[model samples]
Target: MRTLKKVGFSLISIILFALLSYVVLDFLVPKSNSSSSENEEIAQQQSRVFLDLVAVGDSLTEGVGDSTQRGGYVPLVADMLRTNPNVKNVQTANYGHAGDTSSQLMNLLEENEEAQADLKEANIITLTVGGNDLIRNFRQVGLNGSVEDFETTIQEYEENLNSIFSLLNQYNDEASIYIYGLYNPYHYYFAEFEGLQAVFDLWNERTVEIAENTDNVTFVEIDSLFNPSDAPTETEVESNSGDSLEDIQDTNHPYLFEDDLFHPNDSGYKVMASALREAIEKELEDTDSLLSMNR
Candidate 1:
């Protein structure tokens, strides 16, 4: 009897211990799951929720060289944004017009009520200007045009660009604005004219300065992506003994449209779209970091 009692007691003790262990494990498993779920929720919160993109400006934004007539980088960016798991949906409003200068864009911004409404609702705004302005100056003066010749044009462009930013802010202070920098399309035509390249560089510099001054403004540079060149200037041409224009000029640039050789072809627009997507992602990541820090 004593042996039996001892055996029973041992069995009971073992059963109790096993039950307790099971209960403890069950509780801990749930807690772990809850913690993991909470972490997932936090991560989701850090991601951008939605994007309402508004594209406004000149031929690039208007998708001039796009063979599909799909509005060039505008649609491409929207498609890219949709791939983000956090973004539920994406809507785009294209206000892009061909041959619009900065001043003309500003005027449109001030005058177009519909565009103003769209701006107010947009979360992302992309502007492409200054190309027409530069091209106009280039057309007027040609390769012989001095840097001084473009100074006046750049100054005017600066004022117009500032006004454009002001108008955008006035219409929608909450939206992030992205302005594209000008590329030297004429690089192919005037590779030896360092003056034109200098003018293009100066224009981009002024544009960057303007963008820096404005809040929530990002400048996207497409110069080097499409038309990268280190061709000799007029002075370099004079000094070099054996270098020919054909050697310096890269006529094989595949990005340019064969018809005009000025506008970006389909492949070129894809490049621009990629740049815009990267810029948007970077900006959003920075914003997420700030939000995480604040939390």
Candidate 2:
């Protein structure tokens, strides 16, 4: 009877110790299932990709030239990104205004609440500036004007551009900026005016330098697209308008320019949109490559 009681006590003690140990371990250690679920949730969140594009610049961005009067390249880009399999969601905002210069853009960015919000949420940004800056100056001092005259303006533009970039980076460091290089509407009309082209080249070179130096910035070239090898025939120009050659120079490009000859027509907007899409596709590919390498 004593031996049996001792055996029974030993068995009960072992069971109690086992139960106590299980309780202690359950209290001390995290649950593996819950931990795994949380990790999965975090991973899923990390894997999701959203694209929000914010366009801030001049009339071209405002869809002024587009006969359809849609949202210009902003809507086109948004649509493209939405169709992209990698992008889970896409949003876009356009802050373009006619006759807006780099200085104006800087001021708007600093003061505009809506621009600030859009920029803060932007994953991509586009700019079209320096056209009005140069063109307005050209009107003030004809094509023969000395480069010295532009020195002050160029310096101010550079400062404004730097401030713009700084503000954008402050708002969202990851946002990619695509700045459209100025195209010479006067290329056909002023082909002989080497100084005019020279000015454009210099300005574009500086803009390219800025973009190259900045992170996530790209200079989109549209000069060649506007200035094709085969110039528009006299008949084409005459048919469109009876205006003199010089007067029609701006409005000559049937494909690219709107009736005003300055802003991009719908087709012109498409060209810009295509260029942006290509850049974005390249960026996505590069990202994918990096991710694969990481994996």
Candidate 3:
């Protein structure tokens, strides 16, 4: 009987020990989770150095071209980079209000307000500005429906851009600037607006000149990317979709591609993001290759 009693007591103790271990583990589990979350955050922060990128521009920078959340390509591009361990945590402050010209963008930078606090940490930038100026110029010359007088339009455009470039150096010359070259939207409207294919071509020519003058700046030639000749009419809007350009732009201005007639649809912005990614990848790869070669 005594032996039987000893076995019972041992069994009880073993059960109690198991229960206590479970209780202790339960308490520590939350701490483990907390530590894991912290580790993940650290890894994210360590993945990329561009923790802040301040984008100042017109509607495209604000993401007006696409019909998705985050509206345009910059955020999508940011999300794309954020997925890789070597390229995550690239943050941005998007100040791309609708109808803003280059001069207005300069003002936004100068003010350093409205999430302005984020600007100090900015390490890179992407923007598109010349389009609105050209449209406005076209309107002034009564070529509102056509791009007839693109030469005079381009001349004024260049002067405004020079001012914008000078202003950028003041903020952060170290930041790499990626400028999307002007698009060929007029072809979407008029094939030859008022005898002005020359004007449109000249406008792009000036941007190439602008890109050449600035050392840390490069032109992401978006003109050909949106080509009706090679690409379809519509574009894809979702961040993760495999939609084509022909799927996005159908009307004079898709609400997704443009907010009213002036801005781009969300789909348009998606295309921009798609284009921006190609440019950035090439640049970063070139930089890495050059570094490896020197070593």
Each model's lDDT: 0.83, 0.79, 0.65
Error of 1 at 134 (Å): 1.3
The TM-score obtained by model 2 is: 0.74
Better of 1 and 2 by lDDT: 1
> Residue-wise lDDT of candidate 1 within 126-200, one digit each (tens)?
999988988888789987698899999999999998888888898888788899998887676557676877888
Rank the candidate models, highest TM-score first. Answer: 1, 2, 3
Off by more than 4 A, model 2: 1-48, 230-251, 288-295
Model 1: colliding residue pairs: none
Q: Could you give the C-alpha RMSD of every candidate to the true structure, in order shown?
A: 5.1, 7.9, 11.2
Best by TM-score: 1
Q: Could you tell which candidate, 1 or 3, scores higher by TM-score?
A: 1
Most accurate candidate by lDDT: 1
Residue 260's lDDT within candidate 1 is 79
What lDDT would candidate 2 get against the real structure? 0.79
The 10-residue segment of model 1 with minimum total lDDT is: 286-295
Q: In candidate 2, what are the lDDT values of residues 1-295, reduced to their tens digit?
A: 9999999999999999999999999999888998989998787556546777789988888888877777677788777767765566777888999898999988899999999998877777888888888878888899877777687778888888888889888887877789989887766655666677778778888899899999889999877776776876545566678877767665566555545666777777787788788777677667663243222
| Per-model TM against the reference | 0.80, 0.74, 0.66
Instruction: Give the Cα error of residue 172 in candidate 3, in Å.
Output: 0.9
By summed lDDT, which 10 consecutive residues of candidate 3 come out lowest? 231-240
* lDDT (Cα, 0-100) at 231 in candidate 3: 32
